[model samples]
Target chain A: MSASPHAAGSTETRQVYLFATCVIDLFAPQAGVDVVEVLERLGVTVHFPAAQTCCGQPAYTTGFPEEARKVAAAQLDLFPEPWPVIVPSGSCGGMLKQHWPRLFADDPARRVQAESIAARTVEFTDYLVNTLGFRLDAPAASGAPLRVALHTSCSARREMGTLGCGRALLERLPGVERVEHGHEAECCGFGGTFSVKHPEISAAMAADKLDALTASGCESFVSADCGCLLNLNLSLEKRGAALRGQHIASLVRARMDGAAS
Target chain B: MSAASLPQADARVSPEDFKQRSHESLHDAHLRQSFRGAMDFLVERRALQFPDLQAFNTLRKLGENVRQHALAQLPDLLERLEARLTELGVAVHWAETPADANRIFLDIARRHAATLMVKGKSMVSEEIGLNHEMAAHGVECIETDMGEYILQLDGDRPSHIIMPAIHKTKEDVAAIFHEHIDGAPLSDDVNELIAIGRRALREKFASAKIGVSGVNFMVAETGTLALVENEGNGRLCTSVPDVHVAITGLEKVVDRLEHVLPLYALLPKSATGQAVTTYLNLITGPRRAGEKDGPREMHLILLDNGRTQAYREARFRATLQCIRCGACMNHCPVYTRVGGLSYGTTYPGPIGAIISPHLMGLQSTRDLPTASSLCGACGDVCPVGIPIPDMLMKLREAGRHSVAESITPPAQALVGQGSVRRAGEVLAWRAWRVLYSHAALYRLFAWLAPRLRWLTPAWQGGWTASRAALKPAPRSLREQLARRRAGRTVPGR
Candidate 1:
């Protein structure tokens, strides 16, 4: 989306294309809505093309190269403009920004389109902090601060190199205190389809992740990707833990709108 | 366990068992606490020094190009290196496997009439299980590297690449030294610990008839073997003995000194947060007649093992770019927390996870590919820009296919027949939907699903284990759209 909440110009007025990820589309539509609301509040005009489908990450990761190429071709055709594609989910954004070029190696036309799109695509938090130069409003040291734990999704932390951005932004929210989770960068075991394919190993990994999260002693947890949040929430809920989960965008929006006390 | 009493197969643990054991072992309160402390220390130390090392990307690119260029010209460089070493009166040997490499080294030892062999830190030797092999052949082998020597005394495999004894606390080292070193005063003081290791290895360095060491880099231009180490053991192991043997992977060859300089700069910085190690020894075919301290007779064993096979494949050839800096392992979230013993390979962490399956075969290490969360941190922190995550995925595909092929007769029959029948049903279902209205048939099938629980397999049943309960969608998309057009709420709502 556009820059920070307090930028000189109206970021909400700027035009942004929302790349609604397939997982969010099918499972967690509220995350996509939250992204739109956050962007609009920051003064950005959001556009969601109905023609947008899957980012081909499912097929691509499953080793179906031919099917992935078909999906990439359709995606390239669907998003033809040069405007920045703001992706709400880190995994989809990472796939489009980093992996699309490798998907269509033989086709020159699609490869060029993939490269152009990748250059303009940005993860939501990184775009807000780096591109928009958003300065965080430091919360006053008053009242009881809510302890929050941060999890950096694998794609966003390692692929995008924004390991600290989410935590940095969360610390700025009023009445929120960020606690470091042990093995915070470890996988949440939500690797798409990996959970279903190898449920034993996947569940074991999720248990380890939950243990680390619980060790942080934070009542609420936040992560950069919706997929990780969903997997983590499911695990927590299954264990009957009352830990709250929220996306960083929603937290920032809440702070901006003065909804969080 | 004593060296003589140790079981042979215990050294080679199966990957499945390794994963289960590591998962169990990592949960130990003491081990987890120690690992957390060590990982935090390394991460903080590394972060402070390279807070914004902008040139890291450039260095990685250069390292990648240099390695690729070296691998492309490997045959020519090997020939030239052999020729130059021959000119200097040194022998060169090539071995394709651990047995062959060990036989070559033992043959040299036998020819020299050597009873004692002093060794520096050599991961290749570890890969081949050379230490136990040498001991089995009645040749007493002593580890000269301080970390290696401590691990040797503790009767354990290395747990970290650069820092082999990283898992051991100071108290562990003290206990090890107290047990092994006869009448030697033991202390946990870091310098005293160093002194104990130095005192123990000094006698081996002087009395050993032959020396063995691993090459950090090999310069093809001058036939030089470069050994980089923080301790001076590598220097002693390469120079003090009458007969010296240097073993290295074929992938270690570089074109010239200039190409290795940038790598040398990046290696120590990334590995240990040091600008340079204590010693960077370059031996050009061992000792000349005028040289006083160097070994009189030198031998170079360039072992291929499985490296050449990996190098030939374009997709995996990037793995050869690894300089063994251990930076990837240091930063890896999985490797850091679980420790290296969990990997059950000579090289541990991200690099090992990718390359070991190729070298050891997919069937043996099927579990390693699934070890990662596919975090891509290894690729980012790699000094040589290896696409480690991509390689791991490829390994996973290979593992899955291998597993599918290896399924038992009954399992295979069930899967084979079920898949074909399912395929036909799916095709027929799609065809029927396109040709006619199948809304009633779909509703009937959906209604019967919950009653027919026996049709689902255990793995599929496990998929819904976390869900509150499985429930069918109220209406199809087309029906929902029609309902919206009529301005009526859907049935589920």
Candidate 2:
């Protein structure tokens, strides 16, 4: 946990900034805590700038880019440069790495700053596998592995390419097993505001996702995006379904603590 | 193919109103299953076609270049096409509106004293309501494509462009044929049904004085019109009858014959995943005096319903590049789930979502733009490289500002638009925009959400409609982190 894994300077001690997006800040704080624990255990010093807020995805995806730009433009200043910004949620990582640079396209000065931020940002799972080179050490399954379903968020697949990293992280755990399901590539229909805007279709799609997850015979689920986790967990709880979903960080941390749920 | 549940089977077939159609389609188990199977097959087939990534990209780039070049010189190409067509003795007509186009067709039919007209599956015809217009003039417009023929007999509009009868199962088609066609034996075998339809349609093709078809590509270099199909109906519509009348949107024009190749190559493949359709007919002119078997007279009717509206905006012209391949819908999660009937437009799926608003205007189609999950699958599969998700978002912004027409009584806004404005939503987002832009207020709002979680569902639109409850967590990460930082005296993480 002592040797610095990455940085341009290779100073032997590397520090990283955590952009715990608004969703993690509000709806699922435990996921943020688990992210910190995981990174600290890997010997990376994690710093959270209290001034940091959201990645402005709600407004950006909702057809209000102008309103989104106001928040997105301001976020570029929260973290100073060259820390390799790590995000727990791929949706927010997409907003930072993929969406923010586009927001400042018309302005040269801000666009440079935005691109710099985007270049250094990485989703936690992707960083864990690619940069840190930390392999999972499985002790033993003790006869039965804990079956957990994994939901790959849409942005995570498209922007971050973190599905591999998430799977690789899960593969390292002693008793944790990643379960496969039909229609895994299809969206879970929790498209932020789209769920509320078209609730009938949203609920129908969520029910279908649940059908696939439960059919896989997994007792619980974990996803990189809290947006999907929130929507899926709410539906599961509402239906009084036996299956539950947590953010991948919490699931991994919980597995490290000897339980899946 | 599965049969729909008996009670609500026939309840919501029309798309005159999108919301009602979407509501009923989501509840229609039969329709859902039918679309699911058809789309899955189409998506898998399309993926298999371009297994070589480098070749696929090459083909896509070529298609995009051809489309962009043609669109850049559309007016000049159309004039050149008209001149070449005049020299070739193929009558070319310009129709400004749907009424004009239909009138031209009826006049052509009357000139030949045509009573029966066999047609290829033409979506443009559906858009202009040409069959209904022809029927009013005592002309029997018989659809030759098996899918179109089934829907024609059922008096239902096309649900999808390439596969018009996809919403109907073999059993549904069997029931329709048995009910509508006299002495028809009930059969669920697709080949048997196709044979029956071919037998019935073949009888009319010979006796009909005029044939109607839609043009896939209008080649300006040689004034040639290309028709692509699987059932061989398009060839019959253009060649079997003495007088051939072809209809298309103005945007289908190509400057050179070679320019049409890349598009024609991708059209069928993107549609049904075939390397090539069974028929690819290119008609240059009418039958010469010594020619064996072709149309005696040929006419091209270019309809400009709302294409110009799209052309006026630089960004919107991307929609015109589409070849009507239906690949977008095949990969579209939303369209596959709800089916095309829910779109209630001539074009359905992602293309329809962007194009219908311009054709029908923002007044009636405000909800169409918001129907997608913005997963970008439609954009990914588009052959001509139309960024449909970008256009969808652009249209959504346009809808928010477009003047609201007085909605008729009893038809409230589906989500939020028209006469019924979502005042709370406007305030909620506006307040959010203000708060999130400032770090302090953003933290304050995030902290307040969990404590006042009960108030969310009320303002959350329809998110809680089916669920028992939807709530936020008890604490914010900032508070938790602050607590840890205070207690440990050393930022642990």
Candidate 3:
């Protein structure tokens, strides 16, 4: 495997560790597979530690700091080595990079481990665009006729600055056109535990996302985060709307495979 | 009238009522759609500007310290600020209420023989009903902030704290401008819309006898007033008019310029995601000698209006530390979902929910506290680390206590235990004991008896008629657990 998408005839491949988020692990394993495949194809050694578990975001968001610490400690123990731990989901990645250090501040041992992990943690799109400088390889199609709207997850857009990367990757996809939605940066209301705690707010925010998506007249919606996609999809289902939501990786993977055969 | 004879008001909505209203508002299709879109825009824009939370937090801490230090010595600083302003030939007035503040400004305008007042964006002005009060006295106050200008033309209150007309779409703004601006061609372009406002307000700025503005921070050391804005209209408003008047909350003051930097860093980022507002106009003692532009006469009105009360309460003092950057509203799940109009107050969202009740009184704005879901997102995002959720709970308690005090003794007795023995009476009452022990049977009776008028008392039936009781499951969880412990299958299973 080459170290990067641009790396050709390489003598050495960079080692990349995958932190398959809980949602991806249980619900959408294909997203994890897509991540691994994309990384491996881009000339990187992919490692998936079987011991990896939840990022403790669920516990932390729910105000259970003690339970969150336990989960964070376990994650720290699992990823002891210093390698870039690229995560597909920005929410989980944010928990590791931003929240874990704060969660373990009282414990010196855990804090040190969390800090080390945070230093190496990066969201997948950000890693590809910033670190690897993986420019979009495909050209915009002249006239295949597709209009795609992008819904940026709160974690990806707010916690992580992956908006440019998400947009860039989408704009490069063949036969796809981009339409900017008003209030595109707003939360889809899928704030992890917030969805269950305040389902009303979550549902309201999701409905707002769907409205913007529908207003854009986009055939399909693309987002970088799966949690957003799932919540948005649920909102769409509730309203009996027929709009498709896809992860950026899924779209990229499909694009790479030449229009889904 | 005596306090007891002030005309008893109905009890504000209960927490249960607020929850139901919030739930309905959240699921409302149009509301949800609009909120999601608005939140996404703010979140994306903010992230692009401030990518590092650690850096943001550091700046936020510094800002908090500055506010806290200033608040600690507020009396001394206010005196010092007055002395400096007086030395510069500017008048300073202290107003204890909205009426006092409004009267003070109107009196200043009257003394200046003012006709048209060129006003910049000031939430305090809104708080005191300055425009309405001035208008009632036949004074025209034209808003200079572009967002405020649009809302003023459309005759609407500000919807968002920083972005006042955030609820208005480009088309809505275009229509409002076209209708109000004497046949100016309507355009959806924001810059074009601003240009239209600029042209319309240019005459007002030049000919206006008096100008009114809001200070983001008031520095005590040099008696300098700071106004941060993107439009530069604040500068125009302060400089162009012959007389300039600033009305601001007393909480806006700081000890010195040294304390203003961290706040400068945090305010813009939290408000509009800008590294810095386009204009940070620092006016020290009005215009110095030989100045070409700036007010010949300057006045700063520091309005307290319940801030002293808030500052006295240890639990609520942190509220005074709010710089009003409005990040709390911007990131609030409830605020975005329900929109600002639902808040029914000048300040909206998580911050408003906590502060409005205290400022407006518990009875007037009691619904504010119950609007939150206790999601804790607002507390996390607060730059000053204001425990918004905790404060909200306290406000709810205050509301309940106020309600209990005001109601008839019989009504109050229904909610409260009159004496120490009454508590035991409540717990040991056979009906109440049975209701507690058998949750399922209690819920079933509650649901079924609402339909049977003969079985329940008029008061209890009236309460049930007004609000639906909780639907009980066939089997209680405790009963199911007990059956499971006995190694028997439950009926439902």
Top DockQ model: 2
Highest lDDT against the true fold, candidate: 2
Model 2 docking grade: medium
Which residue runs of candidate 3 sit more than 4 Å off their true CA positions?
Answer: A1-261, B1-32, B402-493
The segments of candidate 1 whose C-alpha lies over 4 angstroms from its true place after superposition are A1-16, A40-53, A62-67, A70-76, A80-83, A126-150, A161-189, A193-219, A252-258, B1-9, B184-193, B398-493
Report the Cα lDDT for residue B207, model 1. 87
Chain B TM-score (each prediction, in order): 0.83, 0.90, 0.80
Shift of residue A4 alpha carbon in model 1, Å: 9.4
Clash pairs, candidate 1, are: A11-A43, A11-A44, A12-A42, A12-A43, A12-A44, A13-A43
DockQ of 2: 0.54
DockQ winner between candidates 1 and 3: 1
lDDT of 3 by residue, B1-493 (tens): 1112211212232333444556666556675566658766776677777788898778777877888899888888889889988998889999999999989988988888886798999999988877777777777788899988888777777767888887778899999888878767979998898888899889888889998999999988988899999988999999989889999998888999888888888788777778888899999877778977788889999888777767766757788888888878877767876777666677888888776755666665655665554545676667677778667755544443333332111222211222112233223333433432343554454345434534334332211222222223333322332344367354321
lDDT of 2 at A40: 78
How far residue B274's Cα lies from its native spot in candidate 1, in Å, is: 1.7
Chain A accuracy of model 3 expressed as TM-score: 0.90
Lowest-sum lDDT 10-residue window in model 3 chain B? B1-10
**What C-alpha lDDT values do all the predictions have?**
0.71, 0.81, 0.70
Judge candidate 3 at residue B333 and give its lDDT.
67
For residues A1-261, could you state the per-residue lDDT of candidate 3 as single tens digits? 112375345456578778876566544555666676666666667777655556866545443344456656666776766789998987888788877887777789889988998889889888776766664444432234468888767666656667787777666555677898866756776666456545555555666668888999888888767777767765676566788787777766665655531
The fnat score for candidate 3 comes to 0.08
Write the residue-wise lDDT of candidate 1 on B247-291 in tens digits. Answer: 989889999888888888778877887778899998887677786
